[model samples]
Target: SQTIHQWPATLVQPVGSPLSLECTVEGTSNPNLYWYRQAAGRGLQLLFYSVGIGQISSEVPQNLSASRPQDRQFILSSKKLLLSDSGFYLCAWSGLADTQYFGPGTRLTVL
Candidate 1:
């Protein structure tokens, strides 16, 4: 019974501010974790992924970064926000298969 959860469901921030988003999974161990972003009417873009704790791979070079502090916790952060950074942020987990289960996501708006 693995479940994923993301915080703050929605966020609104001004440009140049700092941002922090968190995700956590329950009932799982050593799962592959991922972070993604989806713009308005656009497809998902993988931002970062982790195969294990402290082992992260960045898929897209952007203004964001991710960290795995615990076995089931992932955190996404930005030093400074930008208007273009506004989008739907998603956290996902997968086993050995190709199927990925995603969280509800966090909608971010930059103004």
Candidate 2:
């Protein structure tokens, strides 16, 4: 029974602030980890993914970055956020090619 946890379910930040969101999985090992951002009416866009420790693949480049330091811990960071950076941040995990489970997601709004 693997599960993921994401913090600060919602956040409000200024135009130029640092951001950090963490996600972790329990009851699984070496699972595929991914970070995605979804706008109001768009599809799920992959930001980053990791197959193993220190092995990451970036699907899209932006002000955000992802790191997988441990087997089950992933961190999303930003040195300075932008107005376009505001959206729904989702952390997901998959053991195979066809299925993935998403977290509750973080709604970030910048002013």
Candidate 3:
């Protein structure tokens, strides 16, 4: 059985600070990892995705970036945070099929 884990669970940050969020998947090999953000009352927005180690694709231009350091680990980072960046962050993984398994997610509040 595969499981996805996201850290911090929740975060409160001031504007202009740095940010780092991590996601890891267990019992999977070379899975396609994804990072998504969901704003209040809005749909899920695809932020970044990785097909393999070091191969990342960005769906939108925002104040965020993602990296896949290992086959099962993905990290989302920001050099400087913004008030508009506050939202629910999700990490998901998928294999050959279309079904994606999601993590518990991290809710960020920037003030």
Question: Per-candidate TM vs. native?
Answer: 0.97, 0.95, 0.98
For model 2, how does the per-residue alpha-carbon lDDT over 1-111 read when each residue is reduced to its tens digit?
989999779999998899999999888888999999999888999999999999989998789988999999889989999999999999999986759989889999988
TM-score of 3: 0.98
* Candidate 2 clashes between residue pairs 3 or more apart in a chain or in different chains: none
Off by over 4 Å in 1: none
Query: What is the per-residue lDDT of model 1 for residues 20-83, given as tens digits with 9 covering 90 to 100?
Result: 9999999889999999999999999999999999999999888999999998999999999999
Poorest 10 consecutive residues of model 2 by lDDT?
Answer: 95-104
Candidate 2 regions off by >4 Å? none
RMSD of 2: 1.0
lDDT, candidate 2, at 54: 93
Global lDDT of each candidate: 0.96, 0.91, 0.97
Considering lDDT, where higher is better, how would the candidates rank from best to worst? 3, 1, 2
Error of 3 at 37 (Å): 0.2
What is the lDDT, from 0 to 100, of the residue 45 in candidate 2? 93
Highest lDDT model number: 3
The pairs that clash in candidate 3 are none
Error of 2 at 31 (Å): 0.5
